[model samples]
Target: MVLSDLGRRINAAVSDLSRAPNLDEKAFDSMIKEICAALLSADVNVKLVGNLRKSIREQVKFKDLPPNTNNNTKRRLIQQAVFDHLTHLVDPHAEPYKPKKGKSNVIMFVGLQGAGKTTTCTKLARYYQTRGFKACLVCADTFRAGAYDQLKQNATKAKIPYYGSLTETDPAVVAAAGVARFRKEKFEIIIVDTSGRHQQEADLFAEMVQVQTAIKPDQTIMVLDGTIGQAVESQSTAFKQTADFGAIIITKTDGGAAGGGAISAVAATHTPIIFLGTGEHMMDLERFEPKAFISRLLGYGDMSGLIDHIQSITRDSAAMKETQKHLAEGIFTLRDMKEQITNIMKMGPLSKVAGMIPGLGGMMGGMSDADGTEKLKRMIYIYDSMTAKELESDGKILVEQPTRMTRIAHGSGTSVREVEELLTQHKVMAGIAKNMGQNKQNMQRAQKMMQGPNSKQQAAAMQKRLQSMGGAGRGMPGMGGDLSQMMQMMGQGGGGMPNMAQMQQMMSQMGGGGLGGLGNMFGGGGGGGRGRGR
Candidate 1:
């Protein structure tokens, strides 16, 4: 079983238990049995699965519950226990080394051949480069033929600075020279890509030691193939003994059925996994967080990860800044909506973005990326069909004139209903923007605080406030309290804007309609209608 299949099976078991009329120990045990079976099929270690089953049973203790406890309460306890245990199964209670700005942080990569060390090195470099770090790559894999050429091509495509010696036969010599040169140039993040053999031979261990000695790296990361299954344990252990790597990065996570096993095996070794290579794309790497990973795995969505992606992608966009200014004033015009849509397009594939939304993921589970992207493009066409006056208005003028809607539909080559649906989506967001405008002063203050010197401290303080207000389980129903608290947090300058929890609540109100009539397109039993151009 793949990770997605495992997640769906486990989720179905939990959901079945939740819907059971008799919330007794029998049903609970059945759910546990199903979950364990699913995990085992996914290649998760038997001992780990057994421990998880035992832990869930101990935590829930269905028989020990109060006689007056309602089924709802009992269900929540069971679900929470499953979520916590699944999270614990992948968490290595250790923190990865964080690179400091303005300083050279040498990150060394080690793993067996074909584990994707070369590609991952460039990805890591680009990741930091996007985050305002002066990141560069050093290709020191002399054992592998064409390693320098491959690194050069990747680095050139990503536009990240790189240093590699095509003529150097000794990996250590190239690594030392690259690091020394980058340090002299004051590059903040220097990543050294080392050579790997097919097997953990003595020569490979000696080569790794020599490179480590040459670079004296700030952090050493082992790249593991997610398809290695239980073998990940022995492989990681051998590398750990030889290189003492500070962190791990698992590649091919999006492809293999043994991904779950690889994660569990690595966690058993007590070394933190920093990232997972989800795809071959340069932007496919995802930061590893146990809770967020498990949450997304179980189809619950990951708000924090979405926020990080948004921040990383839109950090320097002037258009985004302009939209933020407009949002501060409580104005969300069609142009602003268009800009938001464009940003979503830039974020990545629609399937991946949908998974970050609470209920949207499961709703669009069967829709392919091409279909979703086409749906979004049609909405953009509607915006493009509008006149300048129409785009600048709050979409009320278009509604006042039915002919304008028809004109937009004709011009955009879409149906009148899709045009209307687009307006509906805009209306929902416009209402949120108006509410935000009502609290403009608070939003301004929050923005300033976030951009100020003590921004990190202020952000942490606000996060604590959100958690206090039950932001942790915002995916659950009845989020009105959380929404109000989020607005209040904005008012007090505690947070910059409405968070994922707040956005989820708002999107739920539209029945998942925010993304260019996406709710209508997917929720109305079909893909609705395609434009003439499509």
Candidate 2:
């Protein structure tokens, strides 16, 4: 039921379109109404959505769509229109990290309290450190007693030099000193961590200007809580107007609402979201991609850093052994299935993962991505609800007995058909699990083929074929599951499939430990915490 809001909207739109006789002006109008209603209800920017609806209406009215366009074609057109509109709202890529014609590249962090600005500063330092930059930290947040100590601790752990003064006087002085020291140390990147403050505070805004003047940072990033919704627009606007914010990093996305509002807020501001803070862990940071982001919002998985996660977490021997077991015995139990799902969920979302595959996203384009994500969540929930007996039995009793199915549906607040669909999906996945060893081998073979003497010829042929086939006709088997696994691999390294399992375990523990307050903190209880800087 996590996707209840988006799901209901998609169903309504599909239903309305299904009833239409053809893709005409009248049908397009009705579709627009459904889309507008859905997007507005989901807290999308009202004016932006309205303008998008207007554009779609005019396009359908004036442009000559293919004759004999059916509901399916219209649905696809609507999707394209929405995608194009949303893409325009996202920030253009900023210049990569390169030293300006100066001593060192200085980056400043600013945001509201508890927005994770301090943590993000450290992460950025580490990110640059990994990229061979000699990064230094500047703790300008003298307001909080432990703020200096905490940042210094992280700096020590990262083996980076840091500068902070104990005085609670002007922050600009401390920042100036930090930059001077970093310059003396011959550091390549100097990151300053400022005290968190609301943009509405005139005093804080004034203090930010002094700090900006003192450090003359190459990039000033506004770090907002991803849980904050459409209000991000105001936050971005305030900071950009005050200090010329170069980018935005939305933190705490791993736990919260869909983070859709944050995405829209960034789009509205035309500021690129540079990074997403997925968890409290230092390594849980990632660069942003608009398409992958949209796909995740629509319930897809991302695979960009999946291979890296796998490399970090899983030993080759372990994967090879599991692969061998699956191929030789061809029996996949609930445990194996759970492992697979957990691994994929870590990469981010199911759809994102599939989209990473060269030819998969286009083929699965019209599939209700939001609905699919919800379905994946439901499947995970059902697994969570199951007793050990039920899981080991391969869901036999649940499938055979209607009474049990009804009980499960009631317990899960899902329809029996939904439960049935989960079972069917499980069966298909179980088969794929058994065949994965072979598929991975084949993929490796293909990779090797591309490196061989006929590489250019084969590449040319493949490109021509893909060009002729277009995006939709390509069939990418098991790509959906591949996507899910990839995300898991990214979150934690060594590919031991800990991403979803760990999250589920953490959730279960949190749920049981009477930390009910945490759920409310995520804005899922009463839904009152709907916007940022409120």
Candidate 3:
């Protein structure tokens, strides 16, 4: 089974347990057996399969339950046990060395030729650069003819500092020169990309060793191709034995059916996986969080991961802040709508974003099939069809004038109904943004510590501030008056946004898909989007 299918199978196994009328040994054992099969089929090691299965069964059998032990509690225990074991199987519990700013920290990359070593190096550099670290790249792969050119192109595009030479044939010479140059230039994180032979050639290995010894890098990361599956174990071991690799990165996971196998294989080697390359884009790299990965894998959303990805995009902190301020007062313009859509696009595909959420992870593939992206593309064109004045103020002109909507549809080659749908969607998003802004501001105030005479005084002061802030809390966006209510709504599945089906119906009644994604992306968090370059 593919990794995606494996997750469904595992989830189905658990879901079956949850639906059982009685938590009898027969049913529980059946669930365990099904899960074991799914994991083993996904290229997870046999030993891990056996261990997790035994552990889950033992926990259930040995549990200290009262005479009236309920099925819900029993099911939860089994689920938790399974979640914990899977996490343990992945995390090596080893902390890799992190580069501190203002000092040169060299990191070396080693892997087979097709493991995407060069691109991974660029992604790593981009990751650090966006996070305020001065990072540069060095191409030391003299074995490959285009290695230097590829690195140069990637670095130039990302605007990251790079050092390499066309005439340098020896990788060690290039490595030494690149390291010295970047260090002199005060680059904090310097990454050196080494060559990877097709079949682990002895000469290439010796060259890698030579480069490593010459550079004396702070960390040596082994890049493993997830498509190779069980072979990753031997490859990981070889790299570790060669250079004492500090971490591992699994690439091509976006296309690799054996991604799970590679992860499990690396775990068996006791090497910590630092990241997963989820797609072809430079920003497709994601930091590996065991709980988040497992949560998403088992059909639970990784809300934290989703939030972080949203934050990474959405440039212009001041503009975002201004937008939020205006939105809090229930003000949203067509231009603001454009900005939000652009930010979402920058964050990548909608399905990828959906997979990061807790409830939507399981339906990622289906969501992709829902033609939501085509709808989004239409929305973007509709946005592009708007005039400057139409975008600046409220969309009152477009709403008041049907001719304008018709003009937009004609211009964008879309139906007039789509334009109206986009408008109505904007209204819903504005409402949510307003609530989110107010709620976030109120919450920040509540979380503050006041210098007061007593606890009662502070409590009264907080209440007064909340009251002053208009604690109406009805349809409040983001984290507001009742977190439980928001979670309850989320559990009902619209991802705390207005139900998509209902939104579509509303759109059909008047004519909206652009703003539906906005609520889930920013409505809950109301991030300041501070500490980033605007």
Choose the strongest candidate by TM-score.
1
Provide C-alpha RMSD values for all models, in order: 5.6, 12.6, 7.6
Backbone clashes, each candidate:
0, 25, 6
Q: Model 3 misses residue 476 by how many Å? A: 2.4
What is the per-residue lDDT of model 3 for residues 1-534, given as tens digits with 9 covering 90 to 100? Answer: 236677788889988988899887899889989988988877787887898888877767734677688887777777777777777778788887878988999999998888999999999999888777899999998888898899999999888888888897999999999999988998999999999853367788788889999999999998988777777777777777777888888888777385667767567678788888877789988888776677777766565676667666543366666676677676778878877676666766675676665434332335452355555566777778788888886778988988998887777767776677667667766666665665665545444423234534654566566656666444343332333233332332123222223323322322112223443322222112121121
List clashing residue pairs in candidate 3. Answer: 301-357, 301-358, 420-511, 421-511, 421-512, 478-524
Off by over 4 Å in 3: 197-202, 316-330, 361-370, 446-472, 478-534
- Which RMSD does model 1 reach against the true structure? 5.6
Lowest summed lDDT across 10 adjacent residues in model 2 is found at 512-521
Q: What is the alpha-carbon lDDT of model 3 when measured against the actual structure?
A: 0.71
Candidate 2 stretches greater than 4 Å from native: 1-30, 70-72, 92-103, 130-133, 153-161, 258-264, 305-458, 461-534
Q: Which has the higher TM-score value, candidate number 2 or candidate number 3?
A: 3
For model 1, the stretches where C-alpha displacement exceeds 4 angstroms are 400-403, 440-507, 510-521, 525-530
TM-score of 1: 0.86
